[model samples]
Target: MTTRRSTLKLLAAGSLPAMLAMPAARAQQPLLRQLAIVVAFPAGGATDAVARLVADGLRGKYAETVIVENRVGGGGRIGAVHVKNAPADGSVMLFGPAFPMAIFPHIYKTLPYDPLTDFVPVATTSKGAFALSVGPAVPASVRSMADFVAWTKANPDKATFGAPPGGGQHFAGALFAKQAGIPLQMVPYKGGAPSVVDVLGGHIASVVTPLPEVLQHVKDGKLRMLATTTERRSPFTPEVPTMKELGWDVVFQDWSGFLAPARTPADVVARANAAIKEAVASPKVAAALQAQGTDVDINSPADFARLHRQTWERYRDVVRSTGFKAED
Candidate 1:
């Protein structure tokens, strides 16, 4: 409303302050902000720890502020639902172990969210094996799976393997027993740590636990690792044989990855996948993951998608073969 002279006078009289308050160029802004990696388990658990490590890896790469959110309930359903409905802008993702995506669909009577349809596979951060370790209850001469089976047949009442019920390890033990044609029983423990304790104390004949759980004990000769459930030998224990090599088709893995809500743009998914793979390839992340008994399992988006689908189907078939059911 003012003349040019009046505008000039106003600009001279503190217009610099108003100019300084304006935003900078868009290029200065982070590609994404407030990025969240939603974990289905509580904090302090292995899943949450993996998520946090990845979140740390993602900082300054994926977003300016990356956070790992714990949404624990309904056996990972709450976080699944949350991620399923999150904005498809790639700002929010569900970061969790493979079971929530691969096993839950076959185990639960119904899930609030469809893992296959509701999310797009990102990249797995890491993958590790489940192992079979024996305690003193088994004869020291029982070194291989064949020897263990023979001993189990002779000591049928004492042939029990401990693992958490309804977990992949439990099913792996069941499959091993079926394959070996031995009458073996499964003892459920609250967690692998306790189960490892029982195995070490000779309270249980053997245990099906994650490979890392017994690495040190095996190294110290406190326990003996008979076989791993991985399709191949674990890098952490390359000297150990796999159950498959020992004539049992038992294969199980612990994998962690992220899945974006369905309909997220393909480019965004690719970008996220590449970024995550870079984070995984970083020396810090790789070293830490290796220390935890996980391998650098990052791959291209297409490859990861294939792996994701196959793992889901594998768990479905495994659960079906086992006749496992969830309470309605």
Candidate 2:
């Protein structure tokens, strides 16, 4: 072995420095060489937006290559089944809405996979509260939730709100009406984005949808946000009160989580959870998600699993209350 003086000279020669840095470089290596984040919807939708941002955040950090693969079909069932059949490694994860786990079984008579058994919770990526926003169809005077209620009572025929069929918006609207004791009408749309189109054109009085889909219009004064369905005020629109805050029992919030195929090793699950938390907690990533009205509500595996179970049970009642019978 070289003496201390010789070691110092070797360091000065850059040989020892290079050798020492190798461990650090290796330690910094990403957990996976490739990670496929599967989104059930097509590109450019709100869910896809969340998936893309997360994939970008994971790049060079969680995995050397992170890609969002859109596996659209069967109202998210196709992608769910795809991920369920994927390898039980950390190489693939499903980044989709909580509906497939929490709501689908109630709606569909036969699902390709058992959500409870086919996947294990990885972590929650984002949460969004549904909002009731009024457009020009309602009098400009109707600004607050109370005002909207009174207006609907006054003009019973015009108390319609555009909502997608059999989704969070539809259920949130139904639950809100039941709690508020108002008989608001629902004008169905194929999707959340299209539902806002009619409300924007003043074809419908308002639209109950995820806040992100209508946030811009509300900010632009094209649509006035009356209330959100979350238990608390939304972080994106803190000034707007929630239905619960306004004395209505309407408390509904939507969240998206990542799930890996069942039997993924516990260690792999833990590491994936850590990676997602770090990736989402990054300031830039958090800001971008917030800008899209998606809160980076990172959840630990255990916490997420608990929440999933609660939602799964809660929606079973909620769906029954709505009296919606799916044909398929």
Candidate 3:
């Protein structure tokens, strides 16, 4: 009994710093007023592209400079860790995607940072859905998910699916395979662009991807859309059937959102959040997002936090059910 009490006291003592620092940390904002927005993935990707757009839109909205820095490495873990460890002054923020923010914790055994404990949600800039698209060489009549599944089974070794490794697109393919009761040979590519190349060049049967990456191909008849992963139909592509509409009961969406280091001051977070909301609400920004087939969903901090939680929970369940490994 005495030893137990002593150990408890020692543990309490060790946590003193966190307890004591809370008050001081909340007292005042840090000196650096400028905001550094970190993008985990390489330039030209969806997250990077959206971060640049938000930065550009905030030009006259805030008094301080809002600079976007691309910290590309380790499938977005590097940049996410950088933001997690950055000073919680609200000056350093990160634009996180599905990988680091939602999918990493489930797959990685020991992550350098914690998504819930290390970051505070600010706002969700945009949300988009995924689609299964077949290249021009594939039969144009392959319009339904079941039809595609049948074709894959008929030509088991011959059919190929291209997707970016460890991305939501890859997960989409995996989930589709699991649900449709078919086996697909996923061919991992460097990025979505390369994956699209393989699909368009007749190298792969189909590619699962966010609408922005393959919207043109579908419209131009270079690719055929089988189904969308959106809960409902996408506003841009109402003609495309969703997995849910087809009675599959699967819904997945890709989102780009802003997150600051945990414990950033309320005022700072509010300021950043307000700027983001304004940026997304702008006509030009809204138009740009629509152009990419992404919905301009600028949610409040609390609502965005809820969405973040839901995303993580859904993917975590997938990891657990599939016994996914963290080898990457």
Candidate 4:
């Protein structure tokens, strides 16, 4: 029938545009050629270590070449800015801790990049906690946080803690000092390694830094962990107690993840997210990060972005409450 033929032609015409647009839509999708996971700190540090692990995991998973580039400076701002200014094509990404994204914006008077707008979180690689360690300056008998606080009170002149200047560790030390009702002086170091070194050499009474940086020293008997800034005991150090258990309400944990520039196609972000989740889920990658005291935390891009926003707000409140400001 003529009417039936016309209806069929109209149906075929309605389907033709979508069928023809499929190839063009696919053509517009970005193809990843090379990938770079930028680290804000120098190589050999924990951030770099994780970045390299991710780079290895993503090497054959997405782009042809996945390399880690250290753009170290400005306490991670330099590297973050580098990634922010990069093209939003999924070729360049930042692989580092959440400090620059969540904490620094609240502390710094002027930040080069807006964490909420400049980047899209791809995946969360790991979560880690900081350790409150006492060096040779504290007596071996002083084991717990209460004992350390008593010792500091008894030795006011030697009551000083060291942490990297303008970092979460420094703020954690400040918060601990405030909550413990101790008059402790904060000695700033350039990095965790140096701070740990000072604590080992008795230059400072204690050091508040990530557990991974001081875990080996604790094992070697060079340093003693008094408490961790974690809600619960870290699996890496089950014997250690949390600050909360000691009746101090101090709890801080840092998360590291991958972030691509904003405006990158949603599919590209999803692709990167999938590759990252797969890479982090790999046994070898998880084991490598675990060996560094980092627990793998794979999450969806939406969840990661929400986490970033939540963390930023939390840090903002902390900075406001502490009246902390970074020296330019």
- Which candidate ranks first by TM-score, i.e. highest? 4
Clashing pairs in 2: none
Give the TM-score (vs. native) of candidate 1.
Answer: 0.77
Task: Sort by TM-score, best first.
Answer: 4, 3, 2, 1
Q: In angstroms, give how far residue 69 of model 1 lies from its true place.
A: 3.9
Residue-pair clashes per candidate, as listed? 0, 0, 0, 0
Error of 2 at 144 (Å): 3.0
Q: Each candidate: what lDDT? A: 0.82, 0.84, 0.80, 0.85
The reply for model 3, stretches above 4 Å from the true place, is 1-34, 63-65, 326-328
Point out where model 2 deviates above 4 Å: 1-31, 150-158
What is the per-residue lDDT of model 2 for residues 79-121, given as tens digits with 9 covering 90 to 100? 8999999999899999977777888888878889988889999
In candidate 4, what are the lDDT values of residues 1-328, reduced to their tens digit? 4477876785777965675588999855444678988888766567777888888888867887988898977878899999999999899999877777888887777889999999999889888889999988888898888898999899999999987666788788888888888988899765676787789999899999888788888998999998999999998899999988988778899788999998999988989898888888899998888888887888899999899999898888877777786645
Q: With candidate 3 superimposed using the best TM-score fit, by how many Å does residue 277's alpha carbon deviate from the native?
A: 0.3
Candidate with more favorable, higher TM-score: 2 or 3 = 3
The TM-scores, one per candidate, come to: 0.77, 0.82, 0.83, 0.86
Q: lDDT by residue for model 3 over 185-268, one digit each (tens)?
A: 789865576778878899889998778788888888888888899988888899989988877756778677999999998787
Question: Which candidate do you rate higher for lDDT, 1 or 2?
Answer: 2
Task: Return the TM-score for candidate 3, rounded to 2 decimals.
Answer: 0.83
Candidate 2 lowest-lDDT run of ten: 188-197
Candidate 1, residues 1-328, lDDT tens digits: the string is 6678876876889685565455665324356977999987656545666677788888998898999898977657788899999999999999876777788888878778787889998888878678889999888998887888889999999999997666677889988888788998999765566788889999999998777678778999989998998888887899999988877778787677889999999888988997898888888978877877777677676777888888888888998887777745
Evaluated at residue 273, the lDDT of candidate 4 is 92
